[model samples]
Target: MFTGLIETIGTIENYDDSKDGVVITITDCSPILEDVHLGDSISTNGVCLTVIEFDEQRTKFKVGVAPETLRKTNLGNLTTTSNVNLERAVTSDVRLGGHVVQGHVDTIATIVDKKPDGEAISYTFELRDKEFINYIVHKGFIAIDGTSLTITSVDDSKAQFSIMLISYSQSKVILAQKKIGDTVNIEVDLTGKLIEKQIESNLRQQMNNEESQLNKLISSIVERKVKELMK
Candidate 1:
């Protein structure tokens, strides 16, 4: 798992598209690659990718993205010069700076508005997959391009939400590079998803139990009526 805190930004060096999938080579990601191995996982633009290869100098690494992942995220639109948020998987020893981020992007969202909010910047995004809004709540945690942010406001009907980024976050991550209409990978809070699943499961089980009891009651009543008629 990952914490939505971005470590640094990495520049895309090359994008190789094949029948299998796309292979992305990024350079200048030394910070994340400091203790990296061949199988280490890295969050690239909020997508969890395994390290397929890395340079001896630890300046660059290559990750292969499957077609399904490309379709779900904005990674397919990345170019050679595109800068992406980079984060290494959190270790058991480090403090959880940000909320739990699995790096499993659910959908892509489009930036509808960007404005200055005092020293911070506020961005409003419209989700492409509106169904995911069910799990998003105002003041809840959301990961945009792997940066964990709290939702300032949410328009549930319209499937849009706004988030404010402090000056430090804007300067440290690649959010500054984004503009209106640009798409970003989105990962809603994991806790919310788990809660929703549990609630749904409980509701289904309760409904089934109620239905079974009603059936039993009807059968007992019908049997009594038959006995009275026979008598």
Candidate 2:
């Protein structure tokens, strides 16, 4: 799990594609690779990827992504010079500064607009996938491109929030690279998703049972009226 607090921004040195899958090599300022092994997992642009290789001197790590992951995320559009968000997995000793982020991006969203709202900046993003909006709530926590944020306002298809970004966050987090028309990977709060699904399932089941009872009552009423008319 991740706290949605971005630790560093990684530069995509190279992206190689083959019939099997895509391999991405990224360089980060975080000494994340110092102890990183070949099988370690890293959050890249909000998507969890396994480290296939790394070099100590370059502070670089390589990860292989399947076609499905590339299709679901903006990784497919990444090139050699693309900037990607980077965050290492949470350890037991670290404080949970932000909300829980699984680094499993549900889908990608596009930036609609951004403007200066005093010192903090308020940005709006258009929800591309219809199902993604169901889990979003006003004042809820969300991770956009690996930066955890609280949703100040949210609608059926849009989310807006003003982020109080510090100098370190602005420089190291992916928020600095945002543009008006850029696409970003989105991951909703895993806890919220589970709770919403449970509520929906219960509501649907209750509605179905109520409908059955209503139909039976209506049928009984009609039968009684027919008997009365016959008499």
Candidate 3:
């Protein structure tokens, strides 16, 4: 699990595609990689990638991206020198700065608008998967390119939402590298997902109970009718 707080921005060094998947190498820009071990999970552009190799002295690490992951996220389009948001998996000791993020990209969203909002910048993104809009709410948390942000507004009819980025965040992360029409990997709040599942389960149980009660009532009425006929 992750907190969606971006630690640093890493530059893509190489991306090698093979029959199995794509092997990505990124230049480590944050100290988080200092204690990283093999098999450590890293969030790159909001996609959880396992560390296959690391070069501490050179400040680099490699991750293998499967074809399915490539198809689901914008990671496949990355090239050398491309900057991406990076975050290490949260430890049990650290404070949860951001909302729970799975580093699982739900869908790719396109930036439809970018404008200044007072001292901050606001970005409007349109999602291709309209069904996912149900998971997004105004003022809810969402992760874009691994950076957790609160939704300022949501347009369900257009399948678009806006997020406000303060000047500090804009300077810290790689959002400055993006512009209108660019695609970004998106991860909705994990808590919302869990709540949705729980609600669905409860609804299913209630429906089952209602069905059982109706069946029992029907059986009781049939028994009374049969008794009357016998008398």
- lDDT leader: 1
Model 3: residue 24 alpha-carbon error in angstroms:
0.5
> What do the candidate models score in CA lDDT, each in turn?
0.93, 0.79, 0.89
Kindly report which residue stretches of model 2 are placed more than 4 angstroms away from their true locations once superposed.
Answer: 56-58, 157-168, 201-231
Model 1 over residues 35-153: C-alpha lDDT tens digits?
A: 99998999999999999999999999999999999999999999999999999999989778889999999999999999998999999999999999988998999999999999999
Off by over 4 Å in 3: 28-30, 56-58, 211-231
lDDT, candidate 2, at 76: 91
Each prediction's TM-score versus the true structure: 0.91, 0.83, 0.89
RMSD of each: 5.1, 4.3, 5.2
Is candidate 1 or 3 superior in lDDT? 1
- lDDT by residue (1-231, candidate 3, tens digit) is 888899888999998989999999899564767788899999999999999998857488999999999889998889999998889998889788888899999999999999998899999999978788989999999999999899999999999999999988988788867899999999988778899999899867766785666566877899999999999
> Of the pair 1 and 2, which is ahead by lDDT?
1
lDDT of 2 by residue, 22-115 (tens): 9999985456666687777888988989999888684898999998998888889888888888778988897888889888888888877777
Deviation from native of the Cα of residue 41 in model 2, angstroms? 0.8
Backbone clashes in model 3, listed as residue pairs: none
* Ten contiguous residues with the weakest lDDT in model 2: 157-166
